[model samples]
Target chain A: MSQPSDIIQVSNPTQTSTKSALKGGYNPSLGPIQLPTSYQAQLASTASSKRNIYDHSLSRRAPEVNLSSLSYIFNVMIQYSQKNSKGIQELEGKLNTLGYSIGPKVLELITLREGKNAKREIKLVEILQFIHTQVWRTLFGRVADELEKSSEADDEYMITDKQPLMSEFISVPKDMGQLNVNAFVAGIIEGILDVCYFQASVSAHTVETPGCPNRTVFFIKFDRDVIERENLRFHK
Target chain B: MSKSLKTTGEDLWKNKADKVNSELFTLTYGSIVAQLVRDYKQDYTQVNLQLEKMGYDIGIRIIEEFLAKSQVGRCQSFKETSEILSKIAFKYFLNITPRVENFSTDGKQFSLILDENPLAEFVELPDDEKANKQLWYSNVLVGVLRGALEMVQLDVEVAFVGDVLRGDDATEIRLKLIKILKDEIPAGED
Candidate 1:
């Protein structure tokens, strides 16, 4: 973890004497940048620190958005994809591609908040749990319903999140055959998987679990190559 | 008095539960379009001509947030960014981070292993073959990332390396960081 560099204080030498009576207040340049108005006042109020502390304090007060907005956008995305698509498979493909595109950007944003304390996840299981909990919470406002190890393979796992936000109001028409309205969600999962540098296969499938209203399982199978690398990392 | 109070109640009910309300989407779309028109001196007709144009606009800003929040510094190579992308960025933002398992000796090539994919939760591929070809829903993602990264001056070729539709065991996106340009800080002094 790298410590943030010292905050660069740009003081005007000409005004240094005039401002000395003010007890070396905030450097004008260091004043809150063009943050959203909602956050500007909060940042300004907390901007009392003379140097690096003020910068860190401002960054801390930065606005964090709720998952509802993303959910609303995703709902429209589903409608848009449905309107534009020719059939079910094409929609799924489209959603997957969409998820792929957003994956890298999502990864970047999440890691930035972790700052220097963030560590690279070396173990396969640990990374999986991280995704099931942290990624799920950030995007969906709740951790996955369950995380299960594959009975058939040691390297495989299943993360289930019932009532995913994208699927909240969607009901796939039977006539559309096997089309899942939640393909967009699958795309997001695909994006996360790809960004995490997991060279594995992931597929979203509907499983009927008794008493569970929205039982959906994301079956993730790691490539043999991944297994080999995990082995090496474990031994090392 | 009863009728007037009833009308007010009805209005509140409608306001609170209007599912078909396009206001949020329209406002977001409108703001982006307006900005484009102002920035490029284009007409409103041209602005309405391309609403998807706004996706890229949002992508550029969103990507900057991702970079700042992730605090990913200059990587020695694109490959390193790939690893950081999977482990740190993916984990922090979306939570379902991938594990880099398969690495070609060249270090330029590797595979990301995903165990949990949140987006895929409750997802099922449509069974119709025709729908598969016509609906390229996921293509927007490729464009979003491409546009965002390009704006940041990281010219990289991104594509879905593999997919379950292709009968491959796993879905994979192959991102080849083609070039890292010299950091040209934006025109206005930072």
Candidate 2:
């Protein structure tokens, strides 16, 4: 049902090149004097630290943090971003950017853990389901409440979570108006989708109802290029 | 007394603490560091300073939860404070209690050595020399300690002396009390 064959060639080279580029020279694009973008260098600097993240088993440490601790750190992050932001959208943008960085890393590691069953997804619907079930479960401890496609537009889809974990402890001041912190989660979805060539713009929206005040729906709109490829491959 | 504290910490972790998978916590912290790296644009010092400041903000709020959960009484001395931190605070929250070690002659200073850091899991610093030498991947912990201690009226200085992640002999944090805030209640209690 999915063409896992050809995409491997495309994603394979950069995957290897990524780690080896560490110890390579700084990118000229970042201005001459800038400290080398540390994250790229951070990806695979060996020997500097006696222990790497790999030396320890993924399941070794207790895989849990108290909710209170998470809430405290998350709140602090929001406050820090808010102080630096121009307005609510910018604040949400920063959180989205912050969550975006975690997206790819989580996807890769989780895929690795999925082992032999994991296959590269080439179909739009398959990748969306993978995200709806696997990605959501791993990140938030449960499958999202629902995943539904838009009736109006073929390229638009929505994944709804009744009580999104990220914004549970957060109460946006009434004046801010409709800023869903789950934009961070949306950034995560976009991060995963972009890295895998699904090429979607994901945004978090507050769709509060009397029954579910914390309801958030992540809107995923595929890029023209991605939709074109899907039409060429599947529709034809 | 310390044994009781350990049991209390264990119970909080086992039952009272509402838990989430540490994977999200670890990755989120790592990404925050990466975002800080971009925001500061290769200025590792600013990234580190900002991380510590962020941690401090967390520490202030986190203390209320730590205190309310454990029923820990006012520490009789800085030595006792260090023990509770390693045994109880770290245990129930991050799930690793750094070994408290190398006490200064005055008893005002001490170091904590971490065997496993949950935050830095799967994290490797950039291959660049300056980034490796200058960056403290987990300086937020230092800020967290300072902020949390300050909330309890313990004015303190905390920094990463060494990190195993950096290929140091051990991952250690040095904490020194400047003085107890003598005036009245904690700063944020209003």
Question: Where does the lowest 10-residue lDDT sum fall in candidate 2 chain A?
Answer: A26-35
Model 1 per-residue lDDT at A142: 67
Local distance difference test, each candidate:
0.52, 0.83
Per-model TM values vs. the true structure: 0.44, 0.85
What tier of docking accuracy does candidate 1 attain?
incorrect
Q: Model 2 Cα displacement at A82 (Å)?
A: 1.9
Best by lDDT: 2
lDDT of 2 by residue, A1-236 (tens): 16543322333445545544333333344322222345445544544445545456654434778766676667777887788998989998998888888889879877878778778999999999999999998888999988999999889999999998877888888998878888888989999999999988899999988988889999999998998999999999
| lDDT, candidate 1, B1-190, per-residue tens | 3344334333333343223212222222222233334544544334333333434444565566556554456666656666665655444433435666556566655555544443332222233443223322223334445556677677766554544332345556555566766788779978
Clashes of each: 41, 7
What lDDT would candidate 1 get against the real structure?
Answer: 0.52
- Winner by TM-score: 2
Model 1 chain A poorest 10 in a row by lDDT: A57-66
Q: Which residue runs of candidate 1 sit more than 4 Å off their true CA positions?
A: A1-72, B1-47, B50-190
Off by over 4 Å in 2: A1-49, A58-62, B183-190
lDDT, candidate 2, equals: 0.83
